[model samples]
Target: MKTYQEKRHFDKTPEPPWRDDQDKGQHRFVVQKHQAAHLHYDFRLEIGGVLQSWAVPKGPPLKPGVRRLAIKVEDHPVDYIDFAGEIPQGEYGAGSVEIWDKGEFDLKRESTDIVEFSLRGKKLSGSYALIHTADKNWLFIRRKEV
Candidate 1:
C-alpha cells in the first residue's frame, strides 16, 4: 500500500484504516461508486492481504461477454472493503463514496496478464475476467461461465 499511503493524508481523509496485519485467508470484494472529480466505480478485490484495485470508468459490466475498461490503481488496505464515506476536500479522493456492491469472490485463475474470478455480490454474481491490456490498463469482462 505504499502508493496508496503516499497519495493521501489519512488524518484528513476518511479512508479505511491501514493494517498490516489484515487476514489473508478471506476472499472479499467491493465496488464503490465514487463521485470523485470524475464519477467512476472503484473495483477492489482482496488478494494477498491487500485490496487489488481498479478504477472502472463505467463500472463493471453485468452481462456476459461485455467489457469495461479498468485502470489499475494502488493496492488498498483490505479494511477498505467496508469504507463508505466522504473524503474531505483537498484529499486525494475528495468526494463521496458509497458501497455499490459487497460480497465474497472466488478466484479461479490468475496470472500476470489475466485473472479469472467469480463474484457473489448482491448486485454482481457471475464469472469475470480482468485481462491486462497495457500499462495500468485492463479489460474487465463478464464471462459467460466459469
Candidate 2:
C-alpha cells in the first residue's frame, strides 16, 4: 500500500485514492489497456481488500497455446478497478488508460506453480491460467473453452 501511494500523487492524476473498503464478497476483475512507457495490459482481480495486479507486456492472450509475460505489480485500491483516464506526464505510469474488460471471475485453483481462473468479462469470457515462471514473473495463457 505504501509503495502504491508513494508512486502517484492523487491530486495530479485522475487515479483513485486508497480506501479501506473491505468487501470480500466482491469477486470482480478488470483489465486495463495502459499506454505507459510501453503498451501493456493491467490485469486486476479484487481479492482480500485490494486489487492484485499484473502487467502483461504483450497484453493477454486470447487463445490457448499463446502466452504473454505477466509481471506482478503493486496491489491497487478496489476503487481503481473503474479508473480510466490519462495520468500526468511526470507521474508514475503516466499515459492513457482504458478499461479493456470488466466482469466477475472465479478462482478455480491456486498453487505454487500455477493459478487457474475463469473470467466472465465483456470482452473476455473463459478459463485462464497464470504460471509462475520466475520471481515476480508469470505467463498468462488462455485456456481452451470447455
Among these predictions, the greatest TM-score belongs to 1
Residue-pair clashes per candidate, as listed?
A: 0, 0
lDDT per residue, candidate 1, 1-146, as tens digits?
A: 77888898878887876787877879999999999999999999998889999999999899999999999999999889989999998989899999999999999998989998999999999899999999999999999874
Off by over 4 Å in 1: none
- Per-candidate TM equals 0.97, 0.93
- Estimate the overall C-alpha local distance difference test score of candidate 2: 0.90
lDDT of 2 by residue, 1-146 (tens): 88899999988999988876656658899999999999999999887788989999888888777889999999998989999999999999999999999999999987878888999997888899889999999999998875
Model 1 alpha-carbon miss at residue 63, Å: 0.5
- Which 10-residue window in model 1 sums to the lowest lDDT? 16-25
